[model samples]
Target: MKTWIVLLASTLVLPAHASNHITDSEKKTPLQVETIAQFNGIPWGLVLLDNQTAIVAIKNGAAYRVNLATRMTTRLTGLPNVDNRGQGGLLDVAIPPIANTQNWLYFTYAKPTSEGSTTALGRAKLDNNHLSDWQDVLVTNAVVSGTKHYGSRITFDNKGHVFFSIGDRGERDLAQDLSNHAGSIIRLRLDGSVPSDNPFVSDANSRNEIWSYGHRNPQGIYYDAKTDTLWSNEHGPRGGDEINLIRAGGNYGWPIVSYGKEYWGPSIGDGAEKEGIDNPEVVFTPSIAPGSLLRYKSSNASDWNGDFISPALALRHLNRVSINQDGEYTETRYLEDLNERLRSIAQDDTGVLYIGTDSGKLLKVTLNGS
Candidate 1:
């Protein structure tokens, strides 16, 4: 979940001009930002079917099939019922790798249940501009009540496995429990069946769907086909936001080895590192509140290939992280002048980036001369 801080109403006021070119003295190309559309609700997640058509999910229980060319938003029907409580609602939307062939749309949401709300995964056929033939694939084993930490993000790997994350739901201890789905990344087939090769498939006490465990609240996840890597960004306590390289059956120390301090200023866990617990590839001490993760892949932007791009909510900027072959990285911040809480980002086929903000606006970022 995003920080409890509410955005100032003034942040919604658009600039006199919606487009501007921002250049860094050290870079060759300037980043051109354009306001494409503004929303009345929080745009939680988005995916572009083509360069001009997008399916956007709102945190307030709604989804929209937006026409980027015309600045039109059509509220999509046939979505599942969401809790609509704190940090829960229509979350991430993703297309399978075989989208063009299968026409299937997969999404994650906080599903309302008698016991409480649970992170749920479902899919439907996207045809004629509406969702049809809805199928509920998976849900968390334990449904606890909370407004924070649903940890819902979806990604498809090249090996035909679907991975989705679920937060600890404020139950920090649950992260270490493999029998429960909370605080873990789960892998399954496109149809929602557990993959036999999943890490815990043969374990009697563990959930077979679990791929990795000990996540707090991971809002951003991406699969890097080049490295065959699964990467995730999760929120820590007051600090300690982390970007991790995920491995099957891996144990990430949550409540045990966090670098973050507690909300009231106490150290979390037994310092930052511990034996047998996986360490993060990157840790943000000040907390960027990362929202979405995308692996940049383009023939044109050779320099940026394999880098990770994402919006930082608390930091109010877009981050371009260069991950080198040696597994080290450097971070660059972009669009700081926008000063809005960015929630989601997607890149079009042309390599242009689209970003959604908590200020209820949609923005486009392109290379200066593109």
Candidate 2:
């Protein structure tokens, strides 16, 4: 028989005053420990796949599969060669809709280029303990000269087409260039082809794959189950981290006009509000260095009905932002005690919450709250 431990948060605070953001009796404890893999560095991406397999991304161009029941980690193959410099490497992964029918698993990484470095998407079929028939799915149009700011986060729409977040590639002006795919959200077909219905497909001045533009280095993307909406969290320069409601062809202002300041303590742009540029739904003042995003199941959440929980690398905690029926949000921070720089979060169909930490710990947190 397997043993189970139950832990509840109970923090004691001053009786004179209290705050709405934090409860006086809030806490969390580790229920179980299963150290599947210990890397020399941080783990990048993690998501639970169907049929008892889970996917993970390691920084140095490696991806693996873990069996939750058996705690068996089998390193899969076919990841792109990445420089693994300051902030560029194998970034994020997603299993396309074709995975069910076509057996295709998609991933993104930095491809070494002559000019500098470029981010590219690759797809491979997960066969018996390995990836076979790998294909380079998509490569961004803009050529990057640096190893930083390659936004390779990939998510799929309900239509079976794909949506990817491309970073500004360290060049602020490229974010405003409609002709460039960098610093934009792109929509593409499953076979590395452009979608005809993309936001800027017909405009001669705009790249056809551009779904939305003006993002910095966005790492997280999610399709909301409750609202059927696309949501993302992007990192800010000094401060001013953002959580955005991703819309087709929406232009989210980056260095053109950000809520953050420059490294020299100067204004990033004219101001936060600029004409025709979309404001973030939420912005962080102190800067959380946000990572990947995952929504929570109400069945396991105690007070929150259903909330979008984003991981923070700088703060090393998870942010739980709640949404109304209409998709408007009210925010709360959950699982502060995890004290781990959570890189990714995924839930199994059975309500087991799996979180990947920067220190290479893959945690399965099962909630039992009344």
Candidate 3:
């Protein structure tokens, strides 16, 4: 294994402006990025089990327990059979924030079916080297013919609800449909029951578990308990990637009102704005292809506290968006020189960041002069 340390310079300060064409800038903070370990498959999701140990979900239907202190990895057993098709496999893994459910680990993966596959949320307990009492919390009704656009990422609101995202499943119209679970954010109780207060629970035409709909392919989601915000970043067709402030029952206008062009070069939907649809907080025109998101909360002041960080898969950079009190934000890109397709990110107790790349490498990032 090889290790490289790269020093990141300070971000330039820029005024917050409109969501599209937002510039990148930040306060001066030196950063050091180091390669810590290498894995056999793409580390799709990373969650810290404790201060020194983490569980990583591989994209090819495997999981591993990685010790950050000694750089040793143990292959975890007892995971469900995952369909390792295109963009389908073992995806995001998360641990509940509440104290009582800390023993349970949550997961989202592509569960195979007769038609095709669907994103399923499941949970289990880690028993030494194996998982015990594994249970599928919810098998989403999103099976389709293709294998792309699974849109599986997990987050919790710390208020007895767990939220996960599912893509449009390669069907554009499914985003606007309420009958199925595709192209929506779902909220459920920790035990797999639908939350009564969910946005669409009362409507017989909609799925009871849906929180919001009209999403293309949200790969990154984070809930901020302090501000009561649910944030998501999703991909667009040719461009127009978006970071949205998700709201209950809000329609985000995927194919209906997109700023992106179709793959072959025609505009999408009724221009970029519609009356009732919610607009994105930030939009990326050329598509960074965000894989995972993190709301950085740290005791240290220099660690970009309270900012949104995402790993860019297509652009191969660490993307940061700094938000102010008014909900306006700016963007900053880091580590573009490394040229790695960053896949997942998790932060430790000491404000250090651990990043997983599509190249099967784990990286550690720290504030250099802090």
Candidate 4:
């Protein structure tokens, strides 16, 4: 065995670009993190096709087909021109449950318009080594003239309806308005058609695709198969980040009942709680800047089963929340020693975890001796 050397000379002995795979000494579970691949730009989102292959979205207006083993990345062509402005670019990607038969892939990005940029969701067949027949399924009705707050996370429910989030685009009041798709999670049929049973389908003034409204740049969303619950995490203005159990037609009071204060130190609204709007199950004050969320039901690690894993950017760690059937939760921090700003995380069929970082590294997390 090669003996690891500890340099007593200086605090910063390693080079600036060195790969870090630090494990927490207090961790009871035997797990390991290995950096397997690297990208040229920031990897915003990832979807594993199998253990050895995956697709990654870069924030710099491109997507790549990545080989997990060899680290060979091929840029996927034929995507719509993304408005790669401040806080706007190619975002999340998802594969349908029927991908084996349909060969379809869904993506969300910041689409440019005459007015400005809006969050857009599109789907296309993955054929002939690139995206084909791609078209935008939904775009925000009101295209505001700002580059910030385009909440563009995508997830599919058990009913096969596609759900994607759009941020308020710096327009806080639009979240309360039912007429626009901004600051809401929009659910639609597979063919981009409006589901007739949608809450706003009968309302003449509201957009038919709105599922739940009053979100403020939700970057992470997941559908729990066991509980049939849709969970989302959004960034707060200064200190009031939230994790919510999403429901149809639910109004998550943003700018109205925020636990968070304003960026310059003022109350967001009247108070923390309101009458009709829903409150978040979890609220993080002083802000962790949550980037993505995952619901892990791993057979290998029974301790981690039925737990929610949220990777954060500001905190630079993976958060583990163990929940019981009664809805009580205990929180822990995983991969705390890595000290990297993680972007997205996913798990394979065999219970292996893959993590993407803002520093352009792809890491695999697994139980030791597995």
The worst-scoring run of ten residues by lDDT in candidate 2 lies at 11-20
1-370, model 2: which lDDT tens digit per residue?
Answer: 2325433432322221121233434454444433555555556777667737788887778888888778777788666577688677777778764435467777877877788777788888778668888888777776777777887678876677877788898898899899887898777888878877888878999889888889998888877656788888888888778878888888898877888788779888878868988878777766878888766664544654466676778877666666554535555554555577877777665566677788888776655542
For lDDT, candidate 2 versus 3, the one ahead is 3
- What TM-score does structure 3 among the candidates reach? 0.94
Q: Pairing residues by index, what is the TM-score of model 4?
A: 0.90
Q: What is the C-alpha RMSD, rounded to one decimal, of candidate 3?
A: 2.4
Q: What RMSD does each model have against the real structure?
A: 7.4, 4.4, 2.4, 6.8
**lDDT tens digits, residue span 227-285, model 1:** 78899998888778888999999998998888788989989889888999998887776
Order by TM-score, highest first: 3, 1, 4, 2
The TM-score obtained by model 1 is 0.90
- Error (Å) of candidate 3 at residue 250 is 0.8
Instruction: Name the better of 2 and 4 by TM-score.
Output: 4
How many clashing residue pairs appear in each of the predictions shown? Answer: 0, 1, 1, 1
The alpha-carbon lDDT assigned to residue 291 of candidate 2 equals 81
User: Over 4 Å off in model 4, which ranges?
Assistant: 1-30, 99-101
- Candidate with better TM-score, 3 vs 4: 3
lDDT of each: 0.82, 0.73, 0.87, 0.79
Mind giving the per-residue lDDT tens digits that candidate 3 earns over 1-370? 4334553432423333243443334333456777777888899999998879999999999999989889888999989999899999999999988997748899999999988899999999988878889999999999997998899899999788999999999998999999999999999999999877888878999999999999999999999999999999999888888889999999999889987789899989998889999988777777889989988887777647888999999989888888776656667777777889998999987788899999999888876643
